[model samples]
Target: MSDDDLSEKVGYGHPPKKNRFPKGTSGNPKGRPKASKNVANAVELELDSKVTVIENGRKLKLSRGEVIAKTLVTKAMKGDLRAFDAVTKLLPKRFREPLAEANKSEPLDPYEAEVLERYISRRIAKEDSHD
Candidate 1:
């Protein structure tokens, strides 16, 4: 054999070109199986699912998200403070009532006003004490 042929090693790192995989085909012809639907896709599919609900003694079809929102509003109407907070947070900013404007329109009861005043005074006193 010539010196060039002798110098060309064909072991672990170097395989004969004919033995290598063709450009288009893979060693694994099937290839890795497509990945399953991810968590966000699954959640979106779930939210878009439809369910029947009774409203005003009539059957109604609503999306899962709509049912959840309706339930949240019902709970809030029944004086569930946490549900009310959640409903407010979920509302779009354009639709949400501003707290300052709401407070200005609906004056607090005497007891509530007095309690708020005392709370503010105590907070100020505590800050003064800290200083």
Candidate 2:
């Protein structure tokens, strides 16, 4: 069809000229806000933010990230299995491998150990696949 004929056809997948935005103008003129930060930047800002907490009768300043790590470790120390699992996952491979090896001799609950092994193996496989 000719350009004129195509432009005039406005039933489906096309809108009437009067309803369309004018040529050279935008559907969103203002576009995304200039002040908006991306997710990574926002997360970095939040993790880097300072927090004050009383530690052993003394007030101490810590980053939000540090506070989160402290809380995770504290919960794990109190026998929170989920928190312990999280801590183990966050540990570097050097530390984690040795811990996993040590667990073989220490005798973890059979079911629990099997589940943990499966989870770690799956995580490692996923990470390797990504690489």
What's model 1's overall lDDT? Answer: 0.88
TM-score of 1: 0.52
Tens digit of per-residue lDDT, candidate 2, span 1-131: 67986769687878877789998999998897787778999999999999999999999999999999999999999988899999999999999989988777856799989999999999889879999
lDDT of each: 0.88, 0.91
In each prediction, how many residue pairs overlap at the backbone (N, C-alpha, C within less than 3 A)? 0, 0
Q: Spell out the clash pairs found in candidate 2.
A: none
> What is the Cα-based lDDT of residue 121 in candidate 1?
100
Off by over 4 Å in 2: 1-36, 106-131
Error of 1 at 117 (Å): 8.9
Query: Could you estimate the TM-score for every candidate?
Result: 0.52, 0.52
- Residue 105 deviation, candidate 2, in Å? 2.6
